[model samples]
Target: MDLKPLLNKLEHYRSEKPNKVFTMYLNTDPADPDQQGGKWRLQLKNGLNNFESYLQEDGDSDEKRNYWAVKEKVENFMNENEMNLKKSVIIFATGDDDVWFADILQMPVKTAFFWEEEPVLDQLKEMQETFPKTGIILTQKDQIKYIDADLGTVNETNVYELDLDTEDWRLHQGTHKADSNLGSGGGKTSKKDEFYERFEANRYRWYKSIAPKLDKAAKNHGWERIYLVGESDEVNDLESHMNKTIEDKINKNLLDHEETKVLEEVL
Candidate 1:
């Protein structure tokens, strides 16, 4: 969901004449829900009382009217909506149906409000969903999936699982020279080197194809960093072939996780 519009609305309020911001703070702790709510209920009542008294004493006409409407709107919201998981901190400006802002939190705050020119986003600090994250790449011989733990989302399909290559990328065993005495060991060594050259080349080709898609996903999918996780050989091989730009963004936090149960563990 987009919050830029609400943020823009907040900026509009900041620019309005006779500027005044109305804040409503609700403190809560999931550890002791009932008692925490009881404490904050009193704080809310007292904060509302302070706002009402401030409105009465205010000398500015435009701010007075706006805050008067804000006081009423805030009271209406409180009466109509219960303070639950998502409605941790709800702020409003006037009689508008939409609230100024709301934050989802599971942490404690000071439990207060300010009728000042500046709008506070202190609640954002306590919300994990608001923080930046790294894009986690889950890959194996068969699949490649991108997910972000901070945002709690996964791609619908694996990119590598799609049609890419039909050639064998795995190294195969080659027979050694029949005699231990030095003559044909060079032949054995040459065959082993050839197998590795082809195997490594194919792996790099696969990584080259997947890297650009990852770069696009990181740019468009909202992650500041990237991580790689899989078997050591695969992860390291992919890393070597990644674009330098993507390599710079990699956090290299190789997660030791099961590919089958990754979503459960990473999230």
Candidate 2:
């Protein structure tokens, strides 16, 4: 959810009198008690109708027609995406389609509507303040996962697995792959001890090798904050190696968990 371009556009947008921009922030989260019994459906209906009624009384024919055009588009958008709704839906539109923006957001928003000459952006700016672009780095013994998120929704995920044979961290498209075993014939405890000792000895070097990669990713994705989650020692080691400032560190191994669960736990 890159907000820069949208914010810039909306900030500079202004219409001559009689042409209004319609802004809507609808809370459609099913988990909310206030939204029980599909209350958002009724809210949407009334909100649009209320605007139409107000326009009919005080606005000219062009303004009424403009409101109707935007209203129809808003209704159609909601109808098509209702099944895929997340916590909220936001829309900024105009009758002539000179400016239109709609998104289903994982973060909840206060329901509000406005018909004005310019887009209403106070809520959106507040949301950006609350849920800035963030990067979550999950590290284990030999694997690292990066979750890039904006406005509380994951935008991309990248996985890097250390190739023991080549002693290099290789980027993979998705999450966990088959673990590289330590020894074929050995007591489990003994093998685990050996692996731990070996990793502890070279952890700094391995983390240092990947520090630049994380820095690059942060810059590329414009991560406003970075979080490191793993074993305490591992997290500390990685943090020390990275040049980027870490917003927080959680001493929990979450590489095996699903991405959503990882976010819930660490975020």
Candidate 3:
């Protein structure tokens, strides 16, 4: 899809009164060192690196270089670009306490998930009451899905599911297939095929049922931008496919499809 128009829109949004929005995907865990948390820190670092490069080329000579320094630089960049954090909406999807830092630092942020052990219903109620402006989402593995139905019609939420073959689906099952060829090869093939077909069919039905709800939620909440984080390769692939479908539909309708752009944190 042509992204120039979307880029222009984002530019306009950023310039038209400095509406700054920050979506921070946390990758660090305070308790686990061997988990994916460490890897997320690296991603954040890479974003910091990118920011540093931008600063060296276009920033002032006295720019700071420490952690807080980088944070200041980021804030400065937003200011320079006419992004107003107070007017912007910041979303965070985090599993650990790293998100608390942003709040502790008093950053203009609104968190989505903080990995609480509270019951889903309780959490939902609290979120609705406490963070009325933030969106409430449900995360399955790496895929982020919206699950708020009471606020609007079920048709408002957007659900997208990927249809995969037996082999692909099996990979996500986190199990190894037994060596059936040496034992019960004859009946296994047909059974496996049947299982896969059933699974794929069900997956499609569920996803199709859910996506529109998400779209409706976005509209009801007045969220101009939708961001997806921590999704798996399958979800990412599906998103890309959906974007193409959207682009095609928009083109057919004589409308413009704005490409979604992500600004990675530069280290």
On lDDT, the leading prediction is: 2
lDDT of model 3 at position 10: 30
lDDT of the structure predicted as candidate 2: 0.88
TM-score pick, better of 2 and 3: 2
46-112: candidate 3 lDDT, tens digit per residue: 6656645765675444432322343554344434533222212222211221221231111122223
TM-score of 1: 0.53
Better of 1 and 3 by TM-score: 1
Candidate whose TM-score is highest: 2
141-217 in candidate 2: lDDT tens per residue?
Answer: 88888999887788888888777677789887655454654655658778878888988888899989988999999
RMSD of 2: 2.1
lDDT of 2 at 142: 81
- TM values, all candidates: 0.53, 0.93, 0.23
lDDT of 3 at 111: 24
lDDT of 3 at 231: 26
Per-candidate local distance difference test: 0.53, 0.88, 0.32
Instruction: Compare candidates 1 and 2 on TM-score and give the better one.
Output: 2
What lDDT, from 0 to 1, does candidate 3 have? 0.32
Candidate 1 lDDT score at position 112: 65
Candidate 1 structure quality by residue, lDDT tens digits, 91-174: 645433234655444334556687766566555433334433546675554346555434232333233343423542221122
- How far residue 70's Cα lies from its native spot in candidate 2, in Å, is 1.3
